[model samples]
Target chain A: MVAKTRGMKIVHSIEVLQHMLNRDERIGRTVGFVPTMGFLHEGHLALVEQARTQNDLVVMSIFVNPAQFGPGEDFEAYPRDIERDSRLAAEAGVDVLFMPTPEEMYPQDGGIRILPGPQATALCGASRPGHFDGVLKVILKLFNIVDPDRAYFGMKDAQQLAIIETFVRDYNLRTAIVRVPTVREPDGLAKSSRNVNLSEKEREEAPVIQQALQKGAALFHTGASAEQVEKEVAQYITEHSSGRIDYVSLLAYPELTTSSETSREWILACAVKFEKTRLIDNSILSVFSKEFPTQ
Target chain B: MVAKTRGMKIVHSIEVLQHMLNRDERIGRTVGFVPTMGFLHEGHLALVEQARTQNDLVVMSIFVNPAQFGPGEDFEAYPRDIERDSRLAAEAGVDVLFMPTPEEMYPQDGGIRILPGPQATALCGASRPGHFDGVLKVILKLFNIVDPDRAYFGMKDAQQLAIIETFVRDYNLRTAIVRVPTVREPDGLAKSSRNVNLSEKEREEAPVIQQALQKGAALFHTGASAEQVEKEVAQYITEHSSGRIDYVSLLAYPELTTSSETSREWILACAVKFEKTRLIDNSILSVFSKEFPTQ
Candidate 1:
C-alpha cells in the first residue's frame, strides 16, 4: 500500500478505484461522488462538501471529457492543473480522487453514448448538438465505477443537473442526486474554471450575466410576458458586459419544455462569450401564479 | 407478510422488491436475475437454471415490455400466462418473481429509453426501429431494481445479447452478464415467444431456419465465398420451408462490423417470415483460410 496524500488516495485507473469501491461496498459504507472537469473551484468544492457531509466516503472524479467538446471548442486549450486540483480536493476532505485517462475510459471509437431525450436537448444541447449525450454517457460511466449511493452536482448548471435527474428517474438508477446551491464570488460571479481565462476587465464584467438573469426573474415575478422578460434579460446582459450574448432563455425549470401553464417553475438561463472564454449562469424562479402577485 | 407460494415470494411493486433486495444484500446474499417477457418456456427456465446454480437468491422478472414492441408489432397479442409462468418459475427454483404494472414501471411516459449505437442498429434493429432502445431501457430499469450480482440472457437473441453486453461494458455496470446457450427443440428449432404463433406445418418448417444456417456454416467452412454461402442459405430455407425469407445475412461476429480479415470470428444469421411471425437463428463460424482440404 502506498502512503495516503493528506488522508486522501489518488487513483489513476478505473480498475483500482472500482476495486477499492468493492471493498467499501462489502462493508456497507455509503459512498458519495462529485464528478467534475479538472481545474477545481469553489463551485466544485461545494458539491464535494455536500457529498462529504452525507456519506462515509467521498470520491471526486476529474476528467476533461473530450466527447462533450465539439470542433473549435476548448477541448485542446481547456485548463489543466492536476496537482493544484489534487491539493484542493484533499484539503476539501475528499477521500478518493479518481483520475482516468481518456484512452482507458474510451477504448472503442467513442461511439457508445447515451442519447438524451427532448428535455436534455433543449437549451444547452441545442447549441452543442451532442453535448448532453457525452455528459450523460460519462456520468453513467462514473456512477458505475464509483457505485456511489449519492452524487452531488452544483445547481449552477441547473440544466445539466436537471438532465441527470431525468436520466436517473428514467433509467431507475440506484444513485441518488443531491443538488448543491451554486457557489459564487462576493461580486456575484458564479465560480467556474473558465473564469481563469477571463481578462481582469472581463472578470469585472462577468457578474452581469447573473445580474441580467436576476433582472429577468424580477420582471417575471411582476407578471411580465416570457418574450418581454427574455428580451429585457438579453438587452441587459448585452448592454452591461463586454461579452457577446449567446442566449438568454426563459425556460420552464427542470422540464425545460415550453408550457402555457403559468403555475410552474422557470429558469432565466444565459450564456456569454467574453473574449476567448464562454461562461453560463442561470436563476431558478418560482413564478407560479399562486406564488407571485401580478404587477 | 404474505405466505410464500411454494417457498417462493411474488412481488408486484418495485419498492417492495428493492426493500427485500436491500435486506438480502445486507446479509451478503448474492442475487442472480433473469429478466423475461412472460409465457415462460424451457428456454427461460434454462436461464433460471444457470442463475440458480450460481447465486444464493434468484429473481425472475416477468415483464412483457410494451416499449419494445412497434405499432404494427405484437405488443397487444404477445402471449402471457402469468400463473403458468409463476408455477414454472417456482418449479425451476426462482426465489422471487417480480411482476410490476406498466403504470408503475413507466410512471411517466414511455419516452425514457437507452439508445444503442451503430452495432445494435445493424441487422434486427434495422428491421425494428427503436426496438433495442426499448429493450435496453427496460433492462437498465430492471438492473437498477434488482441490483443483481449476475444477470442471464439467452443466446437465441444474439444481437440483443451482444447489444446488452456492449451496454454493460460501456457503462461499467455492476451486474455481470451470463450468455446462456440457445435452448433448441429436438428438431433443431430455436425456442422463441413467437413460436406459439406458429401453425403445426410452420413449426415443422421453422427448424429449417437453423438447418439453413448450419448448411451455410458447412459451405463457409468449405471455403465458399460469402456470396455463395449467403445464396445457398437463403435458397435452402426458401425451398424447404413455407416461410418467406426476411433476411439471410453473414457478418463478422461480436464486433458485427465489416472486416476483410478472415482470421476473425463470424456469424451466419438469418430471419425468416413465417406467415404472421418472424423467426431468427444464427451459426457462429471460424473460417480463417483454406487450411482444411475438402474430404
Candidate 2:
C-alpha cells in the first residue's frame, strides 16, 4: 500500500521500495538514505535534511529493528510514532518513507551476524553487547534494499557511527556514510527518542551528561590520561545530576581502544541512567585542542 | 599490478578491480562473477563459461579464503596454482581474474561475521562447524568488490549454494545468484580442489561416493523412508569401496531438515574417507522418480 501526502510516498514493503529505487537508478538518480527507529526529533530531521540537500532522491526508513536490542534493553519500551515521523519526514523533504514491520525486515532466521571487532569493545559497545551487530545488520539490509549512493547517520551515537563506518569500509559497500553532527536543545541536551521517557525533572537534569563530557573533553585537551579524564567525567556526572553513572570512558576516537597515550584524537563519552532513562553523549577532540570537534 | 594475457586482465588488488569494473558499469555492462579457491578444474571453468555467455563482462576471483578453513583442515595445504588458473581462465574466456593475497583479502581483524542457521545444521556444516561462516565472509567481500549483476555458484556445494541463496534473499542483495550444475569427471566423481590430495588408488575409488548416492536416490524413489535411504547408502559405500563412510544422510532439499515422510524432493548425499582424501557427492530426487536429477 502507498500513502501520499505533499508528494511524499510512504512504502511498507521491501519489494515496493526496491521497485521504486530501481526505477530511480535507471533514470540516473542518486539516492541518499537515512535509517531511523521512528520517533521524530530534530536530530533525525537533521539527517533527513542532509540527505535531501545532497542527492536527487532522499529515502528514509523508520524501522525499530529488534535484532539490535539486547535482552532487558529498550526494544519493547522504545518509542515509535509513525504518523508524527511521516509528517516530520515529509516536512523535511524526504521523497520516500519506508516503514517496514519487523517481520518484513526479518522474514527468516538469518544465520549471518555482523559483529564488531575490538573497536566495539569500549564506549556504548562495552555496555551493549550485540547492539552494533544488530545495527550493522539493519543498516546493511537498508543499504541493499535502497541501493543508495550515500547513507546518513547522526554523531550522537558516536560509537555506532564509528562501527557503521568500519562496516562500510570493510565490506567495500558502495554507499558512502555521511556523518551529521548531533543535534541539541537550547539547554545542550542531545535530542533522542528516549528523551520522551524521561520524567520532567529527569529531562531537566539530562543535559548534565553533555556537560560532564565537555568537562572530560577539556581535561583531555590538557593532556590528561584517558583513565583520569574518565574518572573526572564520572565524578562530575555523579556530583552534578540525579543520575547514576553507567560509564564514562575516554579512548582512541573511532578505534575505541584503551591506551594511555595523549598524542592523537580521543572520544570523551559517557552514559548516565536516570530513574526512567539512560542517556549517552560524546565529544571527539584532538590532543591539545581547545575545541570540542563534535560539540 | 595488471597482468594481461589473451585479453584476460588479472588484477591483484581490490582498488584496481573496482576501478576497472566502475568504468565498465559507467558504460552499462552487466557483470557475471565466479568466486573460487584456485587450482582450477572443469567445474570452475564451467562457471566462468556460463558467466561469459550471460553477461557483457565476466569476473572470476581466486581466493583460498583462510577463514573458511578450520584448524587442521588444509588451510596451509590447500592447493594453489594461480599461474595455471589464469591460463585456464583466459582459455575459458574470462575477462578479469582477481587473485588477492590473504593479507590483501583480510587486511584487518574484521569484527563482522556471517553465520548460518538451521539449514546449515546438517550435511557439510554438521561435519565442519563454522565452515559456511567463513565461506560467507569471503563471498560477501568478493561480491562487494566485484558488484556483479549476477554471481555464479556450483551445485556441487549444494548446501553452500542454499546458504548463499538464503543470505542473498534475507539481506536483499542486489546481485542475482546463478546456480551452475556441478561439473564432474568421466567416472562420475565431482571435480574438487582436494581431489589432488587423493592417491591413484583413492582416486579410482572416489567415484563410488557418487554411485552410492545414485543408489540411495533409487531407494528413495521406491518410497523409502529418509532413514532407510541413508542406511542403504551407508551399507553400499562400506560394501563396495575401500573407503570409510564419513556420513550418509537424506534430508529435505535445500532446507536440509530431517523428516520421516517421503512425499517430496530429497537430497541423498554421502561422504567417504579414502586414505588421504574425503569425497562427497549427492543426487536430488523427487518421490518415485526414476532419474537422478544432478547425475
Candidate 3:
C-alpha cells in the first residue's frame, strides 16, 4: 500500500485492494465506490463527496478501460493525469484510490462478457456499438474486487446509469447504485474530464446540449410525441453548435424503453461530437408534471 | 425463514437469504457455497459434507438452471426431488438450502451475459453450443448472491469446473473455488442426477467411462500423444458399452488447451450418450508420473 496525502492509500493491484477491503468489511465498514477514468473533474469530485457522506470507507478506481472504446474511438486520446487525480482524490477524503494498469485489470482474454440488453441500442450506445458491454465488463470486475456497499454514478450519463441500474438489479448484486445529479459548469455545460479536450468555441457552445434537452423535455407539456421531442432536441443542437449530433433519444426512464401511452416517466438524452470531444447530457421528466423536472 | 429439520433454514428469496447472510457476515462467519441442480445424490451430499466441515455457514442452492440446457435437451425431464433433497441436505448438515423458483431466480430477462473463451470449444462443449455461456451466467448470479468464502464444485464436470475456475480468476472474485473429487457408486459410475435417466443396462455399462479414462491415462506411461490417448479412450468406451460416444478429449488440465510435448498435466475426459442419458467423466494425470493419477 502506497501512502498518499493525509494517510490515503493508493492501491495498484486487485489483490491488494481485495485484501484491504476484506479487513474493512470484517470491521463492518460500509464501502462506497466511485469508478472513473482519471483526470478528475468536479463531476467525479461530487460523486466522491456523496460517497464520503454515506460510507465509512471511500474507494475510487481510476482505470481507462480499453474494452469500452471502439476501433476508431478515443481510447488512445482519453485524458489521464494520475498525479493530479491522486492529489484531488486525497483532498476529497478518499480512503483508497485504486489505479490498476490495463494489464493488471485484464491479464488474460476473459471469455466471459456482460452483454447489455436492448437498452444499449439507443443514445450513446447506438453510436458506439458494444460500448455498454465494455462498460459493464469493467464495472463488474471493479464491483467484484471492491465489494462496495454502494456505488456512485452521475446522471450526466443517464443511459449508462440506467443500464448499470438494470445490471445490478438483474444480477441481484448487493451494492446499491446511487445516482448523483450531473455537475455542470457555470455556463451549464456538463463537467467532464473530456471537457478539457473541447476547444474554446466548442466549450462555449456545448451548453446547447443541456438547453436542448430541457427544451425537448418541455415539449411533453404540449403532449408532444417522443419523436417530436427527439426531433426538437436534434434540431436545436444542430442550429446551436458546430458539433455533429450522435443521437437525440427520449425513452422511458430507468427501463430505457420506447414509451407507451401508460408510461409516466421519460429520459430525454442527447450526445454531441466536436472535433476532439464527445459530450452527453440528459433530462429526466415525468409527463404528469406541468413543469420540467429538476436535475 | 422457513425452518426445516434440525433448525436448518430453507430460503426461497434472494433478499431473505442476503439478509440472513449479512448478519452472519457481521459476526465473522465464513460461508461455504455449493450450487447444484437439485436431486440430492451422494455427489451433492458429499459436497455439502465438505462445506459443513470447512465453513461456519453452508449454503447450497438447488435450482435446475434452464439456460444451461440446449434446445430439445432434457431440461423439462431433468430429475427433481425437492422433498428428498431437502431431507438429504438437512441430514448431511447443510445450514441453508436456497431453493428459488425459476421465476424468483430469473425475474426478468437479464441483459448481462458471461461468455466462455476458447476453452469451451472441445469435449462436452463441442456438442453443447452455448452451454458454458449459460453455465457461467447462472453461476455468476449465484456467486454474487451467496458471496461465499469458498464455493464447492465436483470434478465430475471437469470442463465446467475448468471454465468456472478461469472465470473466477479472470474476474478476481473473492470466493475460493474448491474442487471436490467426483463421487461414484460401488460400480464406479460417477454419481449424477442424470444417471437416473439411464436404463438398467445402461446403468450397468456406465462404469465403462471411468474404466476407459483409466486405460487412456495409463497409456501416457508409454509416452503416447494426445491423439493416441483420445483414440484409446474412445475405442475402449466403444468396445465396452452399448452407448454412443460424445467425445474423448485429451487436453491440458485447467487450461483445457490441446496438449503439446511441453504440457505436463493433462485431463483425459469423455462423455457417453445412452438412449436417454449423457454421462461424463475425467481423470487428471501428469505425464511425468509412471502410474495413473488418483481420482
Candidate 4:
C-alpha cells in the first residue's frame, strides 16, 4: 500500500517482477521504464523525471551488464553504486527499482543475443564490437521484466537511441519508446555519470566537445554541406580541445547514413576521448533549401 | 470471440498483442511458442503437440528469416507455404500463427545481430557465418513479439536448441523453455522437410545418419569411452553411409561438450550431407555400470 503512493516496488527476479506487474488488473496504469548500468547521473534522472511525468508507475533498473562490454573494455571498472542509485531513483519518483546482480541477471549457462542491426555497425558499433549487442540484450531483458508501457532513453548516446528505436520497430516490442532531450551541465557539457571520473581539466575541456557539435549544427544551418560541416567541427575540436576525436560525421537523422547533400534533416553526432574516458554527444539540424518553390 | 475459444487472437500489430496481453492481468496463461521458417513437417508438429500439452496457448510463427542463411545457402530456395502452414497450424491447435514479412521484421535502417556464443562457433555455427546471429535475431524478435509464457523447441536441430536455451538463460527471459524430444521416422531418419528433396537412394541412406548416432549411443550403453564412441560413430557414418559426413561426435547432453568418459546421460549427435540435403539427428544414451553404488 505504501508502494502505491510513492509508486515504489523493488524486484530483483524476473518472476517477481512479472508477478507484481500482473497485479494491475486494469490497463489504466501506464508503466514507464528507465534502464541504466547504475551509477546514476542527472542525465539518468532526466529520463526518470520524463517517465514519472508521463506515466503512472516508473520502473528503473540498475544493471551493469557484462555482455555489452567487449574483452578488456572496463566491465569491472564500470561504476556501480546501488544504494546511491536507489536513493536517487526514489527521489526521481520511480515506482520500482529493478536492481538485479550480474549473477541474477545472467545465470550460469545463460546465452542470448540481442543484436541491434546495421545501426550497430556504424558509430559506437564500430568502436565497441559487442557493446550494442550488450545494450540491446540487457535493455530487452529489462523490457520483458518491466513490460513498461513506455521506455525512456537519453539522446546523449544518440546512436544508441537510434539503434533501440530500430530494435523496437523490428521486434515490434509493445513498449512505447520515448527519447528525452539530452541533459547537460551549465557549461553545455552533456551530463554523464562518467563525467564524475573526469579530473578538473578534463571536465573543463569537455564543454568543447559540445561546442564543436553546436558549431556543426550552426554550420549546417548556414547552408554548409555535410562534409564541410564535419571537417570544420573536426578541425575546431582538434585545435581548440585536448580531446581526441573518435569520429565526426554528419548523418541523416534517425537513419544515421553519411551523406553530403543535406536535402533533409540530419544529426551531427560524435564521440571524443577526454583522458581515458569516452564521451558522446549530438545535435539535430533541419536542413532546408532557400530556393524551394512554394507548393 | 471464436479465436478466444481456440486460445487464438488475431492481433494485427505488436501494439495490439501488448494491449490484449496487458488486459489479461494474470500470469497463469502460460504461452508456448514454436518459431519456424514455415513449411511445417511432422518434426515441427511434434514440437507443437508438446507445446499444446504443456502450455495454455500455443503460438507458432511462420517466418523465413534471411539473416540466418549464408550467401549461397538456401535462403532463396528455403521452402515456404504460408497458406498451408496456417491450415496446419490451425489443425495443430495453434492459438496464434504470427506471420511477419521480412520488411515487417527488419526495418530499412535496422541492424540486428543475435550472435550465439562459443558453442555457436562449433558445428553449424562454423559452417554458416553469421547464421546463428540471424537465427538469434529472429528468435529474439519472436520472443518480444509473442512474450510467451513458455517456448517449445525441437532437438532435431540440437545445436540450435542448445544455443536458444543459452540465450533464454543468459538474457533471463521469463518464458519457460521446453525442449521436445527429436522426432524421427520409422527407419531412424530425423524428420526434416528437406527429406522431400532427397533422391530415393539418398533418402534410403539418410537413415544411416541416425543409425551412426545410434551406434554411438549403443557404444555408450556398452560402457565405451566418449572418444571411442565418437570414433566408432564417425567411422560408421563415413564408411557405410552414402552421405558426406559433416560431423559425428559424442557430447555431453545439454552442454554439448566432448567427454572422455561416458556418463549415464550423453548425446550422440551428427550432421551429414546427402547431396544437397543436410540431415541432423541425435539420441540420448543412458550409461549404466555394474559397479554403480545406490543413492
Clashes of each: 0, 2, 0, 11
lDDT of all the models against the reference?
0.84, 0.83, 0.86, 0.75
Off by over 4 Å in 4: A1-7, A11-15, A22-28, A66-81, A109-129, A201-205, A234-244, A260-263, A275-278, A289-295, B1-28, B75-84, B107-109, B234-241, B260-264, B287-295
Q: Write the per-residue lDDT of candidate 2 for residues B1-295, one digit (tens) a residue.
A: 8989899999999999998987325455789999999899999999988998999889999988889988878788888887798899999999999999988888876476777788777887888998998888888888888888899998888888878888898888889999998899999999999899999878887787888888877767766676778888898888878889888877777667775343366777777887776778778766554432221
lDDT of 2: 0.83
What is the DockQ score of candidate 1, to 2 decimals?
0.53
Q: Per-residue lDDT tens digits of candidate 4, residues A64-153?
A: 888788996777777778777877888889888887778777767435456666667667778898788778878877877777889999
Off-target runs (Cα >4 Å) in candidate 2 are A23-28, A260-263, A288-295, B23-28, B260-263, B288-295
Tens digits of per-residue lDDT for model 4, B171-238: 66667778788788898887776787788888877777877777776667666676787788888888
The TM-scores, one per candidate, come to: 0.95, 0.93, 0.95, 0.85
Tell me the DockQ of each model, to 2 decimals.
0.53, 0.52, 0.61, 0.44
**Candidate 1 chain B — worst ten consecutive residues by lDDT sum?**
B286-295
Per-residue lDDT for B232 in model 1? 95
**Which candidate number has the best lDDT?**
3
Q: Write model 1 residue lDDT over A1-295, tens digit each, in one string.
A: 3226799999888888888888425476788999999799999988888887899899999999998888888998899999899999999999999988898888764145677777766667778887887788899889988878899999888888888998898788889999899899998999999898999999998888888888888888777877888889889888998899777777776877666354367777888888988999988887556443221
Best by DockQ: 3
DockQ-wise, the better of 3 and 4 is 3
lDDT of 3 by residue, B131-177 (tens): 99889988888988888889999999999998999888887777899
Docking class for candidate 4 = acceptable
Pairwise lDDT winner, candidates 3 and 4: 3
Docking class of 2: medium
**Which of the predicted structures, 1 or 3, would earn the higher DockQ when compared with the native?**
3
Query: What digit string (tens of lDDT, one per residue) describes model 2 on residues A1-295?
Result: 8899689999999998888877325566788999999998999999988888899899999999999999999888999777888888999999999999999999876466777788777877778888888888888899888888899999999988888888887778888999999999999999999999999988878888888888877777776667778888898888887899888877676777765343367778888888877999889877654432221
